[model samples]
Structures are given as C-alpha cells and as structure tokens.
Target: MNTPILLLQCLFLVLLSGPLFAQRWTTTSQESEQQPLRLHGSLLFQGIYPGFRVGVERPIRQTDFQRSNGRVNSHQRAVLFYVGMYYHPGFHLNTFAGAEYIFRRVGGRGLITEFRSSLALSRTFLGAETYRVGEAGIVETVLASGQFYAMPGLGFGMGKVLGKPGSNRPFAYMVNLNLTGLAPYNGLALPTPTLEIGFRYQLATTSVHFRHRIRTRQ
Candidate 1:
C-alpha cells in the first residue's frame, strides 16, 4: 500500500512541475487580436583587442660586416560591426543572421577590413534558482575571402518586465557577456581569442506607457 501511494505521489508531482515551470518562463500579450507584423532591425558595434606575434628580419651593416636582426611583439586594436534584422515567433526565436564588418591593425602600420556573414543560435538557461540565468550559443561566420568558420560561445543576460502605472505596456532591459570565435580559422591560419561586452535596450509600444506611469502616478 505504501509503495502504490509513493508511485501515485511521484506521478502527481511530475505532472504539476511542467506547467509551473512553463508559467515562470513565459508571458502572454493582452491584445485580444494580434497586431500587424512589423519588421525589426538592430545595429551592433564590437571592439576587439587582439595580440599577435610577428617575426621580422633586418640586414645590418657595421664595420664592413653584415648581420641579421629579429624581434617579436604583440599588436592590438581590432573592431567589428554588424547591422541586421531581428525576427521571431511571438518574440521567441533562437536564431539570428547578419552581416559583419571587421577592422584590424596589423604590424602597427597595416589595416585589414573583411566582410563576413554571421549566423547564431542563442538560448537562455535559467539556473537552479529562478533569478539566475545565463545565455549560450554557437555562431558560424563566413568571410568574403572564402573562409568558413564556427564558434561555440556563451553569455549572460538579465531582464525584467516594466509595467505602466496606469496603462498596459511592457518594457525590458538586458545586459550581455557576448563571446564569439571559439574555434580556429582555416584560410588565414589565424588562431586568436575574441571576447567583448554588450548592452541592449528593448523598445516596444510600452516605452510611452512607462513614461506615463512615472509622470501621472504617485
């Protein structure tokens, strides 16, 4: 009798957990009817500081003698940009596609600019506790120089819903720990670590609503 009761209790708890978890992670719009679809886009700028090792040899002439000199040092200052579309189903899509422009200064005198297409899939992982969340993804980038590469990446994001005091609208703020390029490249024989920080603002019909709340209410 105790065994049967234990089994039934386990089944009941399993059934209840699914709906509870779904509710915690999802929100529904109040609009009785769906609004007209609107296309969305975003502009992103990322700065990268890369360290490189270069080998140089110079001929030396002194006292009727000839010799070769060599030295090694690391160079820095690299930047990249992306302008792309934001698309989703009910604002819950994990994939993004965009074009990227990269700029790098090499040997303290050379600048290289390469254009690439980037695709990524991002997921939000809620921790054991509801408030702790992290984001991770994989980005595949292909450059115009005919090189293809993939990067396994991770990030951290935090968001909250802002409700209007006297109106119906929602707003959210998020910060991210944007990581990219975990794999090595093939065409250029380039293997360098890349990392950056990013901040994002999500604007919706609710921006005005939040303003009204602060202005009209006590």
Candidate 2:
C-alpha cells in the first residue's frame, strides 16, 4: 500500500474518534479536574514468542451506577497508548505502537470487564539474510529488508481492581486476549492472536468522586 495514503487514513480515523467518544460524556456537571495518569506494564505473547510492553493510560470519563440488588457498579472509559516489540528470531522482528480506546465495566467484588478498539503502525525487520537476483544473473545481498504494516485490532478483557471499589487502590490489573490484523502482508491481511497480562499503577494521590447514574430493575 501507499505509505503516505495509509498514514493519512490512519490520522483521519484517529481524528474522527475523538468527537465520537466525547459524545458519550456530555454531562458537564459531572466532569472533574484532570484525572490521574496511570502507568501500564505487560508481558506480551504470541504462541510462545515473548515480548514486553510499557505504556501510559489517561482517564476520559467514568459513570457509577447502583444495581437492583443494591450493588454499586461503574463504567470507566480511557485511552491507552503503547509501544512494544517482539522477535521471532531468524524470521522477523516486529515493532509496533498504537492507541486503544477502552471501555470498562466494574462490577461486584471489583471484577471488571472491558472492550477495546485499537489502531497501530507496525514496522518489521528481516532477521535472515536476503538476496535479490539481477538481470545479469548476479545475486545481490539485500540489507535491511523489511516492510511496514497497518494494524487494527478488537479485543475483550477481564480482571480485578484489588481491594474495595472506591478505595483508591494504588494498582489494578487485567488479562486480555486480542485478535489483531496486519494489512498488506503479502497483499492481504494476516490475523494473529495475542495475549496480554498487564497492570496499571495509579500515580496521583488525589481522588475524585464520579457521578453515579442509577436505575432500579423491576
């Protein structure tokens, strides 16, 4: 694919997403001051191919609710921006950076579930020797043979917040499984399954009370 065109398309999508997610948090009265920044760390795996990821998360909006059983629940929305690299050794080394829009629901006992949409750009480097044949039948060594790919993903995750809800815990964690696709891989998109076991650390000491929207079930 054309690199410039692909880049422009990616930028367009990202720009469009801002206002779309913004519409979900329209209650100005519920908005608080800037939220705490969270740090994230994870072990990434693709069927025994191992790597690590580090990133930061920013809170967007949160809504709390009360269930019919008197249990308090919450929905939190955030964006996670990250960069990571993985190596297949002798095959290829893939490095990528991306942003995910996360929608999380916190339930009883601090159990949490989430859905995410992601977009990234992947650059892969050839790990093995490459050569090209010239018109004169001379073979020339190709150095730094690689390609760029566009990666888009969708995923779901589940985990716990550790401690009571609203306790302002210093840490929370989750395990995620994602199906990510890379485009223009041999002229088509390649689907890959990945796993992430990660945690987020709250860096700020201040706390904010998220406004609750409650509805009683019949």
Candidate 3:
C-alpha cells in the first residue's frame, strides 16, 4: 500500500508540472507582444473566362446576324471590394465580394449580366510588414470556403516587395488567381477561372521621442 501511494503521488506531481513547463516553452518561443487591430480596404479588377460549358437553352439571336460562327464572346469583367482586419504581424482576416458583368448581345439589341460573390482568408508577409515602422517581412495568403453563384470555390494569392522599404511610406504589389463554379438556379454545375493583379501602398506616421536629462547642483 505504501509503494502504490508513493507512485500515485509522483505521477500527480508530474502531471501538474507538465502544463507549467509547456506554458513557459510556448511563451519563450514567440514574441509576447500583441499588435493592435487594424482596418484596411482594397479595390480589385479581374478578368474571367469560362472553362466549362455554360448552358444556354436558346441561341443568342444577335449571333445569328454575325458573319462569324454562332459562338459569342465569353470574356467578362469583374470588380471586387474587400475589407480586412490585421490580427497579427503575419496573419489577417478578410472578406471580399464582387460582380461580374457578362455581356452578350441578345436579339440583335440586348445584353445580359451575371454576378458573383466571394469570401476568403488573406495572409500577408513582406507587404504586411510595410505598415510597420521598421524592418521588412514577407506575406502569404490563402482563401477558402468561397461561394460563387451558390456554388463552392477556393483561391490562393501571394504578394512580394516592389521597392525599397521606407520610414514613412512603402509600396507593394500582388497577384491572385481564383477558381469558381457557375450554374443555373437548378441546373448542372460549371466552373470558371479568374486572374487579377493590383498594387498597394502603405503610409506610416512619424513619431518623435525625447529623452530627459538630469542636473546636480552644488
């Protein structure tokens, strides 16, 4: 009975100390400082093309008058607006949505439009560090759980440094690619690909620091 009790006591002590040791290790491995939350917004322009079949039941009447084949131009223009929050120096959360206006001449005198929305996770590295007063870093971002036209989607993007770092201002450029599905209200699914490129500028405010001097009198 004495041996069993001694062993149980030792085990209990070990278990209690495990969490304390783990906490200390975690604290020392990374910076303990937390960055303040920041808000940012960006505008984007993209070009998209259909990769799969877009089922149109009726033939476009305007195409009938054209001298070329019946296939109408499938290219479209997309505009995106994003609002983002910086939670850390290397990580951020963002939400973005946009509309794609697909114009197809119909009945020799009409046009049609298609709209889409997307939500994603955006990560930043060097570009993100530009907001900091000093030192440069790199940024990588991934976007998931995206919904396009009621269909599921995913995207990935990365940004790199464009010019030298600055004490009060910095510039960065980024490019992104996205894939999404398109379909009728209750029809089969179709997927499309979109590409976008854009640039961003970060401006920093200057801070003045002062030191106090002490004097001794005789």
Clashing pairs in 2: none
Best by TM-score: 2
Per-residue lDDT of 184 in model 1: 43
1 versus 2: better TM-score goes to: 2
What are the models' TM-scores? 0.26, 0.75, 0.29
lDDT of 3 at 153: 45
lDDT of 3 by residue, 130-159 (tens): 322324454434334222234334554444
**Candidate 2 Cα RMSD (Å):** 9.8
- Could you say which candidate leads in lDDT? 2
lDDT of 1: 0.27
Instruction: In angstroms, give how far residue 166 of model 1 lies from its true place.
Output: 11
Model 2 agreement with the true structure over 92-189: per-residue lDDT tens digits: 88889999999988885688899999998988889899999999999999988888999899989988888766423568898999888789889999
Ranking of models by lDDT:
2, 3, 1
Against the hidden true structure, what lDDT does model 3 obtain? 0.33
Compared with the true structure, model 1 gives a TM-score of 0.26
Which pairs in model 3 have colliding backbones?
Answer: 124-139, 125-138, 125-139, 126-137, 126-138, 126-139
